[model samples]
Target: MLILGCMVLIAGCGCLGLWFAYRIRRRPQELRECSMALALLDTEIVWGATPLPEAFGILKERTDVPWQGFFGELKERLSQGESAGIAWKETMIAQNSHFCLKSEDWNVIGDVGKGLGRSDRTEQHKQIELVQRQLMVIKEQAETWSGKQAKMWSYLGFLGGIAGVLILI
Candidate 1:
């Protein structure tokens, strides 16, 4: 019974570790999803020339949490007549808990906040392109780290579990 219990405990630890590793790998994909959504938002702003609130409204419908919460919050803020810069910064801060993006990643996107809806279409387009490029870069780096780290974490978890079980015996 003691041996069986040790086995179970070790298995549980391994599962927990695997979950952590999965999250590590998944973070990059989540960022990519956000990046794609931003790209779509850019197109809407460029071609549709919609108001910020409405543009965000359109984006909110198509996304899940984080992005959904993100666009929805922006729409609400903009609809309430808040300035785009303030609204954006606040919303970006608010969404941090809902997302896995690092602070620098948030800062990268946050930098583009003030430019939204504050400029001529040409300037807005330029800022959007710049933001898109930055996001793509982040996405690339995330993919690279996740690719290598995914296996490393899994092995670390597995080995740690085995070590723990041996220690118990």
Candidate 2:
């Protein structure tokens, strides 16, 4: 009976550990997907030189996911700028979308930023500030969630170990 109980406990613990790991794995992918989608949206907004009437619609169609509130804020900020193209680029950079950059991509964006006309300078600065604020928020949220997840897993492991020891005795 004791052995059976221990086995069950161990199985439960293993399942829990797996579940947590899966969640941890999933989060990074979600972050990446969200980042990539945002990057793409930035590019499109700049290229279009127009505030998308259906920004959410564009995001949903491109990423096949619901628009998040943060993205909404970003869209609003971008739309407020005088020049959409410059606003888009600056916003993207300030948001630390650069973190998602590959070497080739970074180089390309660098070129684009340099080539942007002087008329868009003011809007560009505003975009940078807006994006940076958003990125900081995202980073904090990700860190907090990760810490919570780690603590939860550690507690589960300890409980599982105790159960195993009890069964052995």
Judging by TM-score against the true structure, name the best candidate.
1
What TM-score does each of the candidates earn?
Answer: 0.91, 0.44
Q: Write the per-residue lDDT of candidate 2 for residues 1-96, one digit (tens) a residue.
A: 887777777777867876665555444345555556545545555655534435534665566322243345445655565344454455555544
Q: Which parts of model 1 are misplaced by more than 4 Å?
A: none
What C-alpha root-mean-square deviation, in Å, does candidate 1 show against the real structure?
1.6
In the order shown, the candidates' Cα RMSDs to the true structure are 1.6, 10.4
Worst 10-residue lDDT window for candidate 2 reads 97-106
- Candidate 1 achieves a global lDDT of 0.83
What C-alpha lDDT does candidate 2 achieve relative to the native structure? 0.51
Q: lDDT per residue, candidate 1, 1-169, as tens digits?
A: 9888877877877787787788778788777777788877888888888888888998999877768989999999999999999999999888788777778888888877879878887788888788878888888998898888877877787788788888878
Q: Check candidate 2 and list the clashing pairs.
A: 94-132
Cα lDDT computed for each candidate against the true fold: 0.83, 0.51
